[model samples]
Target: MDRLIDAIERTQNPSVVGLDPTEALVPAQVVASFADEVRDSVDTPEEAPAAQLAVAFYEFNRTIIDAVAGIVPAVKPQIAMYEALGPAGIDVYTMTCEYAAEQGLYVLADVKRGDIGSTAAAYAHMLTGVNAGASAEAGSAGAGAHDPWHVDAVTVNPYLGTDGITPFVDAAKTADKDLFVLVRTSNPSSSELQMLDLADGSKVYEHVADLVERWGADTIGEHGYSRVGAVVGATHPQEGRALRERMPRTFFLVPGYGAQGGTAADVRGMFDANGSGAIVNSSRGIIGAWRTSGRYRKDMSADDALALVFDTAREAATAMRDDLRAVL
Candidate 1:
């Protein structure tokens, strides 16, 4: 958590670009580049299309990382995007985590995993490579070039309660990594359950916040924040402000900025007075700028757009950085 905060302080930008690529969002050229062998199978068989899609997603992520690595402190790759392609997709997800770290950006695997017993432990190991084993070979390998699934942190779902979340918390402590538990998510439907009032007069999310503070008690870092963080959506400014007050030492991974209808003004409350404690994320607003915005959109082939995509993405990233700096 301290390292993440330090990176944000150094950059003076509490923003992270989300690498949530999909077939619709990826450039046609990238897909075509890897689809030659699989093209025939895509029309007849099913296996090849998934394989080709995994490669395309990887190539697309590589391009996005190259474009924004110089500007942002972190990159979050949603695991589902890669999982859509099956095992090949999962392999790309691992590769993406490794590649982003190689680019000197904090990799937050948004896996949202929650379970019980060994299953939960397995999720922690596979996602963050935390508490994998104590073998001399494993220790020597380290969390680097050899560790393909290494991530600085992971987002987890907390609905299953402490039994499911503790493994991740323990693993994060052991590995010097972090965990962002889902507290107040950005989706509109989140309120359906999260906002329900308890018999004690506290909201569900507020209760969750109290639990987060307890879970993170021992893992507070040099910055006076914990390795156990919370995912507070930027879309709910009032709730965000309340969460900040409730979890004073909890780092926040604020999503829903930009494309999700969250602006800099909406997320200002997530940060502390020192302008630290949180990292805001923007996905399509940065990655798919060329396709969404009138300023960058063009009717060109994916190959033609390829030349401009990185440049457009870099410009969008820079703009987002500037926007956050203006407020923070």
Candidate 2:
């Protein structure tokens, strides 16, 4: 938590770029460019397409990471974007996290994993890196205990209650990593559960917010924030503001800013008086900037397309920084 706070202060930017790449977001030419490279690398023709896209996803993530390395303090890479392609994509997701960390940026993995006691402990290994050779994607047989995920934090689901979340909290404390529990999400369907009224006179999200704060109580860092963070969507401004007051020690991983129609003003209340408690995120709005930049050409070569990706992504990231800075 202190590490992330230091980064935020150093970069003076509390906005994190979401490195979520999709087939529609990545340039076709770039995907095609890797056809020859992965054609023979795959086990069969059925595996070649996914393998090529996985490689392209890495290239896209690498380019975006290089572009925004110094401007932004962190990046949130949603695992589902890569997991959709199967095993090859999962490798790329880890590769993206490793690269972002290598470039001195915080990586927040949006995995949202939750389950009962033992199962939750197994998932906590992501932060603890305690499982040796857990996944072959992990560097080597003995490298699993050495921060194989390369992420500073991860998003978790709290539906299973304390028994489910305690492992992640303990793992975070042991590994000096952090975790954000989903509270008030930005998606349209999140309200189906998060906004439900509990018999205790509080909403579902409010109850979860209290649990999240309690879970991180013992691990508050020098920055006045705990190792456990709350994922509060930018779209729910009034509620987000109240949550900010409700959980002073809990940091925020705010999502749904740009593409989801959340403006800087909408999230201003999520921060504390010092403007240091929350970090906002923008996914397609940044990584997919090239598509909407009007500077892209279908006929452009792979190198040229990637160059555009870098330029546009950087521009968008800078703009987002300024936008958030203006309000803070």
Estimate every model's Cα lDDT from 0 to 1: 0.84, 0.92
* Best candidate according to lDDT: 2
- Can you write out model 1's per-residue Cα lDDT over 1-328, one digit (the tens) per residue? 9878887877777999999998878876668777676666454567887888888888788888999987999999998888877888898998888898988899888989988745677666644343344542332212322345858899988898888888788778767889999999999999999999999999999999999988999999999999999999999999999899999999999999998899999999999998888999999998898676554434566665665668778989999999999998
Across 1-328, the per-residue lDDT of candidate 2 in tens digits comes to 9999999999999999999899999999999999999999988999999999999999999999999999999999999999999999999999999999999999999999998977887777778775554364322112244666788888999899998898888888878889999999999999999999999899999999999999999999998999999999999999999999999999999999999999999999999999999999999999999999999999999999999999999999999999999999
TM-score of 2: 0.96
lDDT of 2: 0.92
Model 1 vs. true fold: TM: 0.91
In terms of TM-score, the best-performing candidate is 2
My TM-score estimates for the predictions, one after another, are 0.91, 0.96
Sliding window of 10 residues with minimal summed lDDT for model 1: 136-145
**Model 2, residue 219: displacement in angstroms?**
0.4
Candidate 1, backbone clash total? 0
